[model samples]
Target: MSVTYLEAIREAQAYLLEHDSRVYIYGQDVGAFGGAFKATKHLANRFPGRVIDAPISEDAMIGSAVGAAIEGMRPIIEIQFADFSTVGLNQVVNQAATLFWRTETPCPITLRLPSGGTSGGGPFHSQCLESIYAHFPGLVVCTPATVEDAYSMLIESVTLDDPVIFCEHKYLYYHLKAESLPKDALPLGKARIARAGRDCTVVTYSAMLHECLEAAEEMSAEGIELEVVDLRTVKPLDTDTIIASVARTGRLLCAAEGWPWGGVNAEVISRVVAEGFNLLDAPPQRINAKDTPIPYHPKLWSVHRPAAASIMAAVRNVLRS
Candidate 1:
């Protein structure tokens, strides 16, 4: 049976709860309501007290999780949506993120953010905040693009000593699938070459990876082979793999679902220009969502985010440069 990206996440959480007594899930409606997306469906019944729900306050939820982590409990917090996480930004970026650095105590907390855009989700519900969270020093921001990465990276995040921002794309929850759960996975912070090519390199993560792959296939028909790199974690970026990919292709294009200003794509291009200037045959470019709040209308939203057509156009521009 094919396991979807959402299922892999649930399985990973189940595995963590079953094996680790210190691991518990905390969020609003996470206990019985099964989360806004049902990622924790029936988990409360299986784990009982371990999957307890919290009040609607995001700040309170994060604060409690941070406290739990400091006391040796590994807390997995499920924020209802990525945008809502801003309500508890202080606890996340200041408290949980700096806990270990300040007190030399490992704060092992996994903050699961249901990220990315979905139809009619609008500005409040549809947001990709990975770049914002990744800007922090101590947070490990993971953006899993596939089912296997979704499962393994989450498990790995809880096991780590630092705080983790698990940005599981909302759009990929049911759309992406795998043949089975992963027994072994690439280490976190490693970039995978989703599709290898020599004409150009496309560095992307989360739901954007699939868009890049589609663009790559279209370019291949025109005899242009675009190398697609899936960045599993935005923070602790795998610069080595990215530079190596650029070394071979000599042209780079970074794509993301977030806005254009100082985002993950911007960072990718900045690193390439700064560290591997000699590897470029052309100027690095990036594509992101327009600098405006996400629209509610489906037609407008369709053109608002980067898609295969836009990605292909960007690739063509990079090739010409």
Candidate 2:
């Protein structure tokens, strides 16, 4: 049976609640209202005291989750919109990120950020800030591409000793679907190749992975084969798999839902260039959202972000170069 991306996320939450008594979820409208995306729909009724609805203050919600994690509870805190995470920067960066450094208290707090564009959420609602969390040392940032990974990574994230920024793409919430997920899963730090090829390597995650896959299939018909590597875990990135792919194809292109300046692509391109610079026919390229906020109207939305055509152009440029 096929399961949508939202269903996979719901499964992950339900599994955590059933498997671990210490695992609790707190966010805006996450309980009775079942969250803005309804990923937690009916979960409040299922887990009476566990699925809590917090106030609109992201700072307070993160602070509460941090305190709970310190006291031996695995708290999964949702920021509602990834854009609103700016208000809770202190709790995320200074407090939750440095809890172990300050003392021996392991903050097993999972910050679930519903991020990325494509929903016409404007500047105030949609944004990809995973790179901001990646700047910190103690946080484990993850953005799974497939349904199976979305289902399993959430479980693995809650079990981690450090804080994790679990980024869920709003664009991919229900767009992606897969037949029954695997009962057993891989570790959190691994990357998966959605499509194998001997040509250029297209590194992407979240909603952009689907675009890359579509572009790759289209490009394949034109005799330009491209391998798609989904970086499931963004923070502790699987550099080994990335470098190996680059070594095989001798070229790489990164497509992320983040801004062009100082995003995950910069970090990934830097690592590849520093370690695997020799394994390139041309300098690595990236297809990222423009360095601006997402617009509201559908007409202006196309100008703010990268699309399949943009990614295909980049891949073709790599091939031509």
Best by lDDT: 1
In candidate 1 the C-alpha lDDT for residue 66 amounts to 88
RMSD (Cα, Å) for all candidates, in order, is: 0.7, 1.1
Report the lDDT tens digits of candidate 2 across residue range 1-321. Answer: 799888998989999999999999999999989999998999999999999999899999999889999899999997888889989999999999999998989999999999888656888888988989999988999998878888889889998999999998888888788898669887988888889998999999888888899998898898888999999988899999999999999999999878888878999999999999999888899988877777898778776787788899998888878
- List candidate 1 stretches off by more than 4 Å: none
Question: lDDT value for candidate 2?
Answer: 0.89
Candidate 2, position 101, lDDT: 90
TM-score for all models, in order of appearance: 0.99, 0.97
Per-residue lDDT of model 1, residues 202-289, tens digit only: 9999999999999988889999999999999999999999999999999999999999999899899989999999999999999999
lDDT of each: 0.94, 0.89
Candidate 1 TM-score versus the reference? 0.99
Candidate 2 to native Cα RMSD, angstroms? 1.1
